[model samples]
Target: MNWKKAMTATVAISTCALLMSSTIWAHGYIEQPASRAYKGSNALGLNTNVGSAQYEPQSIEALKGYPSAGPTDGHIASGGVAGFGPLDDQTSTRWHKTDIKTGALKVQWKLTAQHATASWKYYITKQGWNPNEPLKRSTLQEIAVINDKGAKPAANVSHTINIPSDRSGYHVILGVWDISDTANAFYQVIDVNITGQGTGGTTPTTPTDPGQPSANAWSPSMIYVGGDTVSYDGKTYRAKWWTSGEMPGHSDVWELLAGLQ
Candidate 1:
C-alpha cells in the first residue's frame, strides 16, 4: 500500500470536503486594517486568552489531555501566544466586553460523545460584556448548546456557531456529564479565526474591507502569527489558520483559520 500517497490524498480530500465554495482562496491571507476606535493596536488583532474565557470551557489541556507540543489547539504554550486559558468567572451577570475596534471572532470545535449519551453547551461574551453585578434572572444570557453537525441537522450530533449581533465575548463549552463516565469519550478539534467585523454593526476604516480592495485602505502586506511554541511569552500565544465561505457549523469538516486570504 502506498502510505505516503494515501496520506497526501487524504489531506487533499479533507481540504476539498471542508471547503465547498469557489470564492475561498486556498491558503490565502486576510489583512486587518488600522483602527478608528483604538489607536496603536492594529484595527484588528486575533486573541484567545489561554485559561481565559476565550477558550472552550471543558476542552483545555489540563482538562482534555491533548498534545501540547505545537501552536495548535490543546498546546498550553501555543495558546500562550493567543492567551488561551480558563477565564476568571465574570461578576457581571448579563454582559461581557469585547474590544471590537478591530474584528469579530468565529469559534469552531469538534466533538464526540464518549459514552454515546453525553451532551454539550456553549456561550459567548465580551471582555466588558459583563458587569460585576447580576441582572434580572431572565436577563442573563444563556449559553446555546449546538447538536447539529454540518450545516444540516444530524441525529445525536451537533456543530456550527454564529456570533450574536450585539454580544461582547464569544465562548464555546463542551461537557460529557450527560454522556460518559470516563474520559477519551470523544475526538474533536477546536479552531478559531478573527475577522475584521463584529456584531456591533461597525466595520474597519480600511480603504476597502479585508479580502477586498478599497481606496486609502491599509493594503495588507502580510500578517505574522507568533504563538507559545515560538515564544514563551504568554501575551502572544495563539494558533492560526485561514477560512472562506460562510461560517462553519461545529460538525462541518472545515473551520476557518486566521491566515485565510
Candidate 2:
C-alpha cells in the first residue's frame, strides 16, 4: 500500500479500537439520591451543560481502591477529581439534597458503561458529621453491601437498603461500584437530609416476660456467629458470618430477616 493509504488505514483501525474500548468499559455513577455530579449537571435539573462530560469527568482512577484513609476527602463527591471541585464544597448552594427518612431507602445508578461487578457497597456519614469539611473514611459508616459476583448490571441497577434509624439531618451517602475484571471502580456521593424520628420508634416493645426469645437488640461490641439472631432499629437480622464490631444495618455480616415475628 502507498504511504497515504497505509496511514489512513492505521488511523481508521485506531479509531475503531478506541470506540470499542469505550463501549465495553463504560462505568457508572449514582443516579438516584442525585450524586454531586449528576446534581450539578442537567441530568438532575441543574442548568450546567455537563452533557457527555457528565459520566466522563466524574469518574476516578479506581486503582486507589475504595474506603481509602488518605486525602481523598476533597474528591469525595467527584470521585477524586479536582475539576469537579465544586462538588467537594459542601457549602455550595447549587448542591441539592434528597429528603429521606431513616428506614428502607432505594438507591439507583445509571451506567454510562457497564462492567462485570464485584460488589456494590454503600456508606453514610455519621450523625453530627462535619458537612463543611471534606469527607473522610473515618467519618462514614458502611450501611449496605450487595455482591454481584461479577455479573453485569443493566443500564440501571437499583438497590434497597434499610437505613440506620439513628441517623438524622444532612448526611452524605457514598456508593462504590467495584469492577470484577478491571482495576477501576466508580464512586458516587449523594447528599441527603434524614427527617422524621431518629432511632426512637424503630424497635417495637416486647412482652414483659423475659423468657421468650424476643428480638435481640444488636450491639457493635457483640460477636455474632451464623444463625445467631438480633434486632436493631425494629428489624431482625441473622448473622451471615462470624463477625464482631460490624453494625447490624450496615454490614454484610448480618442479613436482615424480613418476616420472622
Candidate 3:
C-alpha cells in the first residue's frame, strides 16, 4: 500500500508540472499588417537577429493589463521576455513599416493557442515621439479596444478598428491580447507609415506626372512636386520636387520644355 501511494504522488506532481508548462507557453501574433514577431519568423524573414522569435513567432506572452501592469517601458515590443529582447531595439529604420491610411482598419491575429479572452486593445505612438528611442507608454495613445467577455476566440480572429485621422508619418502600434483564464497577455508591435492628409479631411491632390500639363503659371505660393509643368512667359517648364517661388529657367529644379507645341 505504501509503494502504490508513492507512485501515485509522483504521477500527480509530474502531470501538474506539464499542464503548467503548456499554459505558460500559449502564444499568438498579429497577421495583418505583419507584426514585428510575425516579420521576424523564419517563414517571412522580414528582419534579422530576431533570436528565438524567429523560430516561435507567437511566443511573446507577458503579464496582462498593458501600460499599467504589463511589460516595462523600452521592452514593450518584446513582452519583456529575455529571449525575445532583440525586438526592443528602437530606430526609425530598425523595423520595416507597413503603409497604412486613416479610418477603419482590419487587424487580424493568428492564434496558435487560443484562450478565454478578456479584451484586445490597440495603442499607437503619438505624433512627434522620438523614433530613435525605445517605445514608452507616455508616447502612446489608445486607439481601440474590444471586450471579448471571457469567450474563447477562434483560431483566426479579426477586429475592425478605426484609426484616428490625426496620426501621420511614422508610428508604432502596440497590441495587447488579455487572456481571461491566465495571468498573461500577448504583446505585438506593428510599425506603420501613415499617408493622406489627416485632419484636413480633404483628398491629397495627386502630383502631376511627366506627361501631365500644369493647369496655370506656377504660383509662388503653390507647392510643386517632380514632373509638374508650368507655362510661364510663353515657355513651358517642368518643375521638380517642391519647386516653390523659383523661376522656371532660373533654377535647375525647373527644366525648359521643347516638345509641347
Off by over 4 Å in 2: 1-24, 47-61, 69-71, 92-94, 198-261
What is candidate 1's local distance difference test score? 0.26
- Model 2's C-alpha root-mean-square deviation from the true structure amounts to 9.8
True-structure RMSD, every candidate: 19.3, 9.8, 17.9
Write candidate 1's Cα lDDT for 83-167 as tens digits: 2322322232212223332223332322221233233333233323323432112222333332212122112232233445543
Candidate 3 or 2, higher TM-score: 3
TM-score, prediction 3: 0.67
What are the per-residue Cα lDDT tens digits for candidate 3 across 1-261? 999999999999999999778656757899898998889899899988988789877989889988789899999999898789999999999898888887767788888887888888889898789999989899889877666557666677666556678788888988899999989999999988888543322211233454656547777766544446788777778754333577877887677765665
- After superposing all C-alphas onto the true structure, candidate 1 shows an RMSD in angstroms of 19.3
| Top TM-score prediction, candidate number | 3
> What is residue 254's positional error in candidate 2, in angstroms?
21
Over 4 Å off in model 3, which ranges?
Answer: 1-24, 197-261
Output the better candidate (2/3) by lDDT: 3
C-alpha TM-scores of all predictions: 0.25, 0.64, 0.67
lDDT of 2 by residue, 73-186 (tens): 666665554455555666524457788888767777778777777777788888778787778887889887666666666666766666788787788888887888987777
- Order of quality (TM-score): 3, 2, 1
Query: What is the lDDT, from 0 to 100, of the residue 123 in candidate 1?
Result: 29
lDDT of 1 at 188: 19
Alpha carbon lDDT of residue 51, candidate 1? Answer: 32
